[model samples]
Target: MRMFDVCIIGGGPAGLKAAIAAGSQGLSVVLMDDADHLGGQLVKQTHMFFGSEQQRAGARGVNIAKELVEQVTSLVNVEVVLCTTALGLYDDLVLTYETEGSYRKLSAKKFIVATGASERMLTFPGNDLPGVYGAGAVQTLMNVYGVKPGNRVLMVGAGNIGLIVSYQLLQAGVEVIAIVEGGPSIGGYLVHASKVRRAGVPILTSHTIKEAVGVNCVEGAIVCELDSQWQPKSGTEQRIDADVICLAVGLSPLTDILWQAECEMVFVPELGGNVAYRDSTMCTSKPHIYVAGDVAGVEEASSAMVEGELAGLCAAKSLGVSGAHLTLQITSARSQLEELRSGPVGDKIRAGLLQAHR
Candidate 1:
């Protein structure tokens, strides 16, 4: 196994930031990702990011990832490994991984996992059809591969993923027939919902998909109003003329490695499924191992990047590094992260953190 001062798993925004931060500190760093390219979900994202100027607000995720990668490469201390899937975390902070057709291993004095999150799945009658897909799948098909998921779409779920994907479907020149929300109102930001509505899309609140109606590929969808208990309301059943049904129920943290690393966890639904417990410094129960990004919990990419920076600083400090540079970096990063945990949407996140700290 090769050894490095720092090794980051997951090459998305968080992992990329971690590798850059560590490398800038004179540490030899490696960023490993399962995808053939860097930028995790960012590459599939074609929308502008929302955040403060310091957070690169209004900039596209693809542009941000490209710029970050370029800067990190110039540092010379960072090596990026693509098409690398982390097998598991072994004893003594050793990590097993796969790249191309070969197996590899690496040991890190300090490790950061920013593997990110995966889309949540929901099962319904006939949902196994080829045209039924996750919101991320729709995004991947349209934005990355330049392929349309379908011409007419029925979006399930009212959260950010659902709303955002609905809008992206329109952007891809597809017709979004309706967005069915199982809850009373939209589960995501009002701004995103408003954007969808302004584009002539109807958001059917307190509604759900009864089944995806198709034989081989998706041909249509069955939707109905739901009561408080989620039971279908009689006389309200309707069929949406659609070729694809995109499910955007939510996201779940991809935490297989964290679990293999033996980190303590809690099932926090708001933070996105099962997550590893971390301290203020983002260090998990296991020493020398850190968790950040969606692998820690599901949040915006901006939040993921901030946590990645903090994790890098904390990991560096844990390795007995002392300098004004690290102090300044961490202090600034913490303050920025604190701001992101404020605001209306952020209040729930902040409350979760308070509970976690407790």
Candidate 2:
């Protein structure tokens, strides 16, 4: 069994930032990721991110992820293990993972879980068809693999994923027939909605996909208007001819390790699903274990990186590694996170957080 001062269970923006922060503070850190590439969803994000300069605002996510990976690789105290799946978090902070056809266990004084989140799928009549895929899957295929998702697509959900993906599809020469949302208004930022609209794609609010039509794959889709209660109107059904059905409904935090670790879990619909109850420092109810990124709550990448740095600093401090700047770092990170979680758009997130800590 290998041991370290800190073991981060992901290699995304959050996990990478956590490793960099803790390792810079003189802690032995090891970061693991199941994917061969280090950047999680960041690699597939072609659009520029939002936030201040410190958060790399105006920079593409792929570029941001590349910069983070380069910084982490240059650190002597931090180790990066790719293509490794962390199977479980066992007693005494032991993490069991599978790597290169072998199983290994590592124990750490502090474990930071930044496993992120996965796309939420929808079930319809032909949901199991071959051409049906999550927004992330389509992004990965088009952006990462340099392959097209489909020639024409019908997108479900008008949230960030749905809107951003519709624009991306258009950029890639794919015809986005339209975007259907179950909500009364677009769930994502209006700026994104405007961009998609200018591209000539229609945004249908209070609408949803009733069924996908195809035998072996997605050949078309059925969309309809919904009432205030989200029930479909019978005569409002419209058939759309498309080869792909993309579901960008939402995401759920990947908290399996947290669940297996027996941390305090709370259901926060605003933040996704059941997430680990974390304090401002990102420390869960289990003192030695911490959570960041979407595992704590489904916030944006900017907040995730800040949460990760805070958690890393806290982990290092818990091990007796400290400096005058440590307190300032924690304070700044917390402030940024709070600022991000405020405002009209963050109302639901605030409510969910309050319920989680309660």
Write down the TM-score of every candidate: 0.97, 0.98
Candidate 2, pairs of clashing residues: none
Prediction 1 global C-alpha lDDT: 0.86
lDDT (10s digit) by residue, model 2, range 12-129: 9899899999998988999999999998989988899997887899999999999999999999989899999999887678889999999888999999999999889887898999
Q: List clashing residue pairs in candidate 1.
A: none
Say which candidate scores most in TM-score.
2
Model 1 segments beyond 4 Å from truth? none
Per-residue lDDT of 183 in model 1 = 91
Candidate 1's TM-score = 0.97
- For candidate 2, the TM-score is 0.98
